[model samples]
Target: MNINDHNPLPTYHAADNRYQEMKYRRTGKSGLMLPEISLGLWHNFGHNADFTLGRKIIRRAFDLGISHFDLANNYGPPYGSAEENFGRIFKKDLLPYRDELIISSKAGWDMWPGPYGNWGSKKYLIASCDQSLKRMGLDYVDIFYHHRPDPETPLEETMGALDQLVRQGKALYVGISQYSAEETARAYSILKEMGTPLLIHQPRYSMLDRWVEGGLLDVLEEKGIGSIAFSPLEQGLLTNKYLKGIPEDSRAAKDGRYLKPDQISGDKIQMIKKLNDIAISRGQTLAQMAIAWLLKDQRITSVLVGVSRPEQLDDNVASIKNSQFSDSEITEIKTIIGA
Candidate 1:
């Protein structure tokens, strides 16, 4: 059979064999469900990047049963370009099957220069969602999030903007990212009082980063808010691509904004080697092991990962096939990371 030849154009149906390997999990106590692994356009789906390749990655992810796609208004190096590129993909490929997907976009970072363009102020959050919807060619998003905490803005006001988004039918659910335990609790109560439950929380978590362990995880458990961890591989530090040195095609080499050369310290490299050995014992790569480790916490609803190529998506999806970690393996990982 010709790879591109088919009588009936494929729709987003579960019967598609490529989707059989994907797994879906419920988000906390909510009725919403998400794939175990969700794709994000945080790095590679910008306007300057190959748009054709971005479309391929999005379509391939859908074919492989990745239903959730996470984006933010300021994701691209040249901010807003990622959403514009995804807008093209939406019109070309995934528009017909929009109902079968959980598409989310966020605001709350430095999207533009003016006061109304940044932070968690009602003006920024509300306006950003409108711009994001326009850019993505969507009527409404499945989820809308505050990309990060805005220290200057009142938490009540920010939550009010999110609540208003739901009331206006612009977003089905709302979430917060990179918020501390205290801030999350405060926002959770405000949303709850407004009759809009906080659906999920996105945080930077990985083998090397445990900022959420002490309090944030407990708060989410108490409030029944689901979590989807971003940078689960620590911005590719957990992957073997950095085991020797930064490869030419690696994110560190391509984009130094997030993953810089200074981040690959001697101690981090040693930890990666030790963790890689442990992953080898489990018959997994360090990337796979890192993902599985994140999923071990049932409160974690999904692992939000970014991929530069199709092969990376394939490898990341394969991690779900072995999500389990034995008690001993967990303890060993803790020892290695010194958690």
Candidate 2:
């Protein structure tokens, strides 16, 4: 059945067939299994966005078997707005299914003013987690991540804080994001000695970016820690959005913070066009192909996706349908992306 077929209802009753189409992958050695396509609140679920539209998109996602919802403390434009918004939606539509969902949040990066409000210090990570729980109206988050590594703070201290959170019951499991191979290994070692094995790692990976491939994936394999890739679309560059020059409303045109106008060079556009051809031959959109490419590696536990609307989820989730690739297609993709 089409999960997105219905209109607004006074109450939200999730589809009984929600788990039929979507696939679930075991998260490393953990008992937890995450959806192949998880929803992220990194964009368009903030104070700047329409509340009703965001709610509709989230409900639609759950209907399609997306049980994981990813968020960060500073996700919204105003910082914490996304969690506040998710709190409202949880109370209204998803509270009943809370046990069936895998909800995660992160800390690190500049969140509030002053030194205590940022970084990987036990103070900041602990305080930020408390604030996030209050904002999201939850007793604990399923997974709490140290969003990025801190140079000043010792790795032991940071991982200790995560261990403390798990022990204290503020977070069921702990993970890290954006750490290098050396750092991931170090963090894993520290957490292992502390008896709170690092559950997963979140990294920015895509056809356009392959930094994680240098050494991180190998480390994850050796250590038996799972990985979830963010930015699998590379800020929408891998999609058909920029095939005919940047639109006025495109992310590159408006959000200069991440996807800049200068980054989309003439050569880049040509490469995207070539990739689009490959996707067409495979009967999938470029976005779908990009996501499917990442999942081809069994080391990648899941691919985190963000969408401005619910309809976008329909296409992204379908990536699992045709994840297989011929050797020739793989070689062609490698030659095109220069990876």
Candidate 3:
């Protein structure tokens, strides 16, 4: 018997009606189904954060029907702290519900030191997946991704590493994040030849950043591969938080690691205010309307969102309630965005 087995904690019973409000979308042409709004641990769940608060946010996400949790090898400020904290939380509160969850991790960015630590070489990819599995305390991740494209590494080598992971039972599916449209097509062809089809593509998409609209969304639609939009709120700029300048506790004010203060210019603030008015007309927050805008496309499988508090999940999940937009509303939004 395990020594820690004697130390029992309070039981966590998930809500029985958790699936009633939220909708699940099929991932690409695959059998997997993910929630419309998946929880992402890119921020707020790290060694620097309070463990109890992180736990509460995670529990609340599940209670609201968020069954998928996204993570990366270098998410935390110190790197790998998010995965470590998530591993502990999983063992404590979510262990029993392992089969009900879809956990994903990536290994393409800078993780450790020296040559072998970063990039998308076969050796690096394999070793990084092993390290991530050990850290998350899981035998297999549902979807393991190459976090970014490596300029130095050949696509064949990187795609091969992902295929090998699936064959080894280390990852059920393989995905590529932030790959260009041509690169995504090449990856799909390569993975198809390898007999392990690429499952999904994660791209940074929002009203403010419309790079994906240029060609990435078209590629995903033609290839029949599911796409998840990260940074769907443009790192909180699409929300009402920046209307009166950056808040003292905002990501921009604190670290600006992702969303810098300078990025929120006067013009951006004016645009946000305009969007907020439209959101109010729809009976939704600006953040909700921003998320709903992404979900307007059928090609988008899910929108990955990060929340600092549990209450935020309730608001984010409620975006699905009014995902459909009127023709006039769309036209007005495009005019405001100058698209």
Q: What local lDDT score does residue 95 receive in model 3, on the 0 to 100 scale? A: 95
Runs in model 1 lying further than 4 Å from the true structure: 1-15, 253-255
Q: Model 1, 163: alpha-carbon shift in Å?
A: 0.6
Please give the distance, in angstroms, between residue 45's alpha carbon in candidate 2 and its true position after superposition: 1.1
**Which clashing pairs does model 3 show?**
none
Which of candidates 2 and 3 reaches a greater lDDT?
A: 2
Write candidate 2's Cα lDDT for 190-247 as tens digits.
Answer: 9999999899999999999999999999999999999999999999999999888789
lDDT of 1 at 94: 80
Please report, in order, the local distance difference test score of every candidate based on alpha carbons: 0.88, 0.93, 0.91
Q: Each candidate's TM vs. the true structure?
A: 0.93, 0.97, 0.96
Per-residue lDDT of model 3, residues 83-105, tens digit only: 88899889889999999999999
| Residues forming the 10-long window of minimal summed lDDT in candidate 1 | 1-10
Q: What's model 2's TM-score?
A: 0.97
Which segments of candidate 3 are over 4 A away from where they belong? Answer: 1-9
| TM-score for candidate 1 | 0.93
Better of 1 and 3 by TM-score: 3
Better of 1 and 2 by lDDT: 2
